[model samples]
Target: MRPPYFIPADRTIDYQLRYFQAKQLHQAVVIDNNSRAVGLITLEDILEELVGAIQDEHDFA
Candidate 1:
């Protein structure tokens, strides 16, 4: 099992990306001020947040 990455809610998006890149992190558990997980963010979610939308040419059934 892989350990989840962690990020404080106050951290900037750039910091989160740096941590993700440096650690090769895939998933992150966002923590509150008390150090409790409040949300989860994944690589895919970050990409989507950054890029907005991506349309694929491949057909899906």
Candidate 2:
């Protein structure tokens, strides 16, 4: 995978959504500063993560 497609750890969720949508990438690889393959971040992965986060917040509330 292209390194430029890798997202920074600090990027906002909205930014990620737009980036992926504009790039037309269904998935991306998560890399560290050392340029190592940390994990995979797909569209489904982000969506699930977002959903889980929202549910967690709701549960806490």
Candidate 3:
């Protein structure tokens, strides 16, 4: 099983991307200041946030 990873809710998109790449993480649970899970995030989400949404051929225009 993969180890669990968490990211602060207030973190910047750039920082999050670097953290994910450094740790080789595809996704992680987002946490508030108190370490409560707020949501989930993925590398794809980070990339899309940086460069706008990514749509594949299967996606409708």
C-alpha TM-score for every candidate: 0.75, 0.60, 0.88
Cα error, residue 46 of model 3, in Å, equals 0.3
What do the candidate models score in CA lDDT, each in turn? 0.82, 0.73, 0.96
Estimate the TM-score for candidate 1: 0.75
In candidate 1, the residue pairs with backbone N, CA or C atoms under 3 Å apart (3 or more residues apart, or in different chains) clash, namely none
Query: Between 1 and 3, whose TM-score is larger?
Result: 3
**Residue pairs whose backbone atoms clash in candidate 3:** none
Residues 1-61 of candidate 3 have per-residue lDDT tens digits of 9989999999999999999999999999999999999999999899999999999786798
Order of candidate numbers by TM-score, starting with the best: 3, 1, 2
Of candidate 2, the 10-residue stretch with the lowest lDDT total is: 52-61
Mark the regions of model 3 whose C-alpha exceeds 4 Å error after superposition: 57-61
Worst 10 residues of 3 by lDDT: 52-61
lDDT of 3 at 21: 94
